[model samples]
Target: MADPWSKKNPFLSMMLSGANAWAGIARGIMSGQAKGQQAAAARQGNKQVADFWTSALTGGTPKRPRTSKKRR
Candidate 1:
């Protein structure tokens, strides 16, 4: 029997959406780094950027990033 939920699981979809958000965060980090910012700062900023969507996607709480996208 096929698992009907594969069609659209909110958790999976939210995670995917979070992935898209992380991609933006990565871009922000890379741009900040190319300009010579501290690694720790970049990571902290990235976390904040990622949190924007993660929090929205997974209730008001921040969720861990699932995957990141490449600039294209």
Candidate 2:
């Protein structure tokens, strides 16, 4: 009592398989892009914080660290 029209044919099966593969690839690409953006934002934030602290400690402008003079 199986319906002949409901049966899976080769072309239909191939198309469905291709669609699934495309979906999986898209998901992977989207997740990787999100992760890369997150990492970049974190790096930018860290740099800003470091700059702020450096300027604050150095009295507005950053300066080179003082080196100790050796005895002659």
What number of clashing residue pairs does each candidate have, in the order they appear?
A: 0, 0
- C-alpha lDDT of candidate 1 relative to the true structure: 0.86
Best by lDDT: 2
Best by TM-score: 2
- The whole-model lDDT of each prediction reads 0.86, 0.95
Model 2: colliding residue pairs:
none
Residue 61 shift from truth in candidate 2, angstroms: 1.2
Candidate 1 structure quality by residue, lDDT tens digits, 47-67: 998998887888886578877
What TM-score against the true fold does each predicted structure earn? 0.35, 0.67
Off by over 4 Å in 1: 1-6, 35-72
For model 2, the superposed segments whose C-alpha errors exceed 4 Å read 3-6, 62-72
